[model samples]
Target: MNFLQFFVWGAWLISLGGYMGRNLHFEGGQIGAIFATMGIASLIMPGLIGIIADKWINAERLLGICHLLGASFLFYASTLTGYDEMYWAMLLNLMVYMPTLSLANTVSYNALENNRFDIVKDFPPIRVWGTIGFICAMWAVDLTGFKHSSAQLYVSSISALFLGIYSFTLPKCPPAKSENKTLLSSFGLDALVLFKRRKMAIFFFFSMLLGAALQITNSYGDLFLSSFKEIPQYADSFGVKHSVILLSISQMSETLFILAIPFFLRRFGIKQVMLISMIAWVFRFGLFGVGNPGEGLPLLILSMIVYGMAFDFFNISGSLFVEMETTPQIRASAQGLFFMMTNGLGAIMGGYASGAVVDFFSKYAIVSGQSQLISRDWHSIWLIFAAYALTIAIFFTFAFNYKNGLKTVKEK
Candidate 1:
C-alpha cells in the first residue's frame, strides 16, 4: 500500500517540469503554476477529506476511491497540450490525490496499532518501502524515456489504478468510535485548535516555510540537470542525459534516512530531529549551487545524499510527531492539517515565488543564431534557496521551545 502510494507520485512528480518545459514550451511561471496545482489541491482537500475519514468513511476505502478517481484525471491530464487545460486537469487530480497522503498514513497507523506494533519504530521501516517505490518509479520513468513525455502521467495513472484495487485487500480503517460530542468536534475541525499553542504554532509556521523550500527543487531539479544539454562542455554528460535517474539518488538516500528515523526520534526528539533536517536542507541546496554533473558531480551526489536527511528528518518525523501527539479520534484530521500547511500553503508559496526567482535570474538569449531560454544563474538561485533554509533553521532554533514544551502541548 505504501509503496504504490508513493510510486504513483514518483512517476511524474520529479520529471513533469522537464516535459512541460521541453515539449510544451512553458515559461517558468506557467510551469510553476502547474506545479502549484498540488498546493492548491492540498490546501483545500486534506483537511476536509480528513474530516470525512474521521467521521464517516473508512480511511482505507477512501484511499482506494481517491486513487481510482485520481487515475482518470491523470489520464486526462496526459492528453492536454495547453497550459490552462493541463493546470486545471492537474488541480482536479490533486484534489483527489493530496488527501490520499494523509489517508495512507492513517490507514497504516490503524493497521499497525491493531497488530500491536509500535508506530514510531515500525512505521519508518514500512515508509522506507515507499521511498524505495519512489526510487523505482523514478528509474522507470527515466530509463523508459517517460521522464520527458506525457507517458509519465500514464505511468502514474496505471499505478494509482492498481493501488486503488489493491487497497481493498488491506484491513479496513473505519471511522473511530469516538466521544467527540459537539458538532465542531465531530467534524474534526477541532484539529485547528493546535494553532493556538505557541510551540505548535511555531512548528506549523516553520513547516510552512520548509514546505515552501521543498517545492522549489521538485519544481526544477530534473530540468536543472536537463538544462546542461545546452552547454557544449557538459552536453553529453550522463546527468544531462538521465537526469531523472540521477535525481533518484535523492530518493535512494531517503531509504537509509527513513530507516534511521526510529533511532533519531528516540535519541534526539522531534525538535532536534527537525532542526537537523533544516540544516541538511541548507547543504542540500548549497551543494547544488556549487556542483555540476562532471567534476562537480560529487557535490551533486552529496546534495542527493543529504536530501535523504533533509526530507525524511522533518517530513517523516513531523508526520510521526503528529501521530504521537493526537488521539485516534482526531489523528487523521491532525495529519491532514499538518500536511495542509506543508504541502498546501507551503507549496503555493514555493511554486509562485520560486518561479519568480528563477525568472528573475533567467533571461532569453540569442545563442548560435537561435532564440533560446538560458538559465545560467542557477548558482545564484540555489544559493538563494540555501540562504532561505538557513534562515529558517536559525529562527526555528530560537523559536521552538522543546524542553517541557511537549508537556504543555499535551496538556492543551
Candidate 2:
C-alpha cells in the first residue's frame, strides 16, 4: 500500500515541469498554475472527503474509489496536448488523488493501532518504504527516457489503477461511532475549532508558510539541472543527461531521514524539529544556487542530502503531530485540515509564487527558429528561494511555541 501509493506520484511529480517546459513550451507561470491544481483540489476536496471517511463510509474503501477515479484522470491527462485541457485534467486528478493521501494515513494508523504498535515509532519504518518506492519510480522514469514524455503519465495511471483495486483488500476502516450525530459534526466542520486555540492556530499558520517551500524543488529541480546542457562544456554531464536520477537522490535521502524521525521527534520535540526542517530548506535552496553539473557536483549532492531532512521532518512529523493533537472521532478530518493548510494553501502559494519568480529571472530565446526555454538565471532564482526560506524559518522560530514531545490533545 505504502509503496504503490507513492510510486504513482514519483513517476510524474518530479518530472512534470521538465515535460511541460521543454516539450509543451509552457511559460513559467503557466507551469506553476498547472501545478497549483494540487493546491486548488486540496482546498476543495480533502476536508470534505475526510468528512465522508469519518461519517459516511470506510476510509479504505473510499481510498480505493478515489484511486480508481484518479487512474482514469491520469490516463486522460496523458492524451492532452494543450495547456487548458491538461490543467483541468490534472485538477480533477488531484481532486481525487489528494484525498487519498489522508485516507491512506487513516488506514495505516487504524491497522497499526489495532495491532498494538506505537504509530510514531512504527509508522516511519513503514513509510520509509514509500520513499524507496518513490525513488524507484523516479529512477524508472529517468532511465526509461520518459522524463520528458507523456508516457510518464501512463506509468502513473497504471500504478494508480493497481493500487486502487488493491486497496479494497486492506483491512476495513469503518466510520468511528459518534453520539453527537449532528450535521456540523458529521460534516467534520468541527475540525475548524483547532483554529480557535492560539497554539494550534499558530502552528497551522506556520504549516502554511512551510508548506510553501515543499513543492518548489519538485516543480523545478530537474528542469534546473537539465538547463545546464545548454552550455557547451557541460552538455555531456551525467547530471544533465540523467537529471531525474540526480534529483532522485532527494528521495533516496528521504528514505534514510524518515527512519530517523522517531529519534528526532523524541529528542527535539515538534517545534524544534520543525525549526530544523525550516533551516534545512534554506540550505537546500542555497546549495542549489551555488552548485552545478561539473566540479560543483558535490554541492548538488549535499543539497539533495539536505532535502531528506527538509521534507521528512516537517511532513511526516507534522502528520504525527496532528494525530497527537486531535480527538479520535475527528482525527481524519483534522488530518485533512493539516494538509489543506500545508499542501493546499501552501501549495498554491509555492506554485504561483515560484513561477512568478522564475519568470522574473528568465526569458525565451529563439534557437533554430524555435522559441526555446533559455536565459534563465537559475543561480539567482535559487538564491532568492533560499532567502525566502531563511525568512520563513526566522519567523517560525518566533511565531510557533510548542515544547516538543508528543502529547494527547488537550481539549480546551
Query: Quick one: best TM-score, which candidate?
Result: 2
> TM-score of model 2 relative to the true fold?
0.88
TM-score of each model, paired residue for residue: 0.87, 0.88
Compared with the true structure, what per-residue lDDT tens digits does model 1 show for residues 6-65?
999999999999898877767778888888889898777876787788778899999999
Give per-residue CA lDDT, model 2, range 1-412, as digits (tens).
9999999999999999999888888778888889989999888887678778877799999999999999999999999878899999999999999888878988999999999999988997887778788888999999999999999999999999999999999999999767344444433456889999888888888899889889999999988988888889889999888999999998888878877987887777787788899999999999999999999999999999999999999998888888887888878667767877898899999999999999999988877765566679999999999999999989888877776475423332
Local distance difference test values of all predictions, in order:
0.86, 0.88
Question: What is candidate 1's CA lDDT for residue 310?
Answer: 98
TM-score between candidate 1 and the true structure: 0.87
RMSD of each: 3.7, 3.3
**Colliding residue pairs in candidate 2:** 269-404
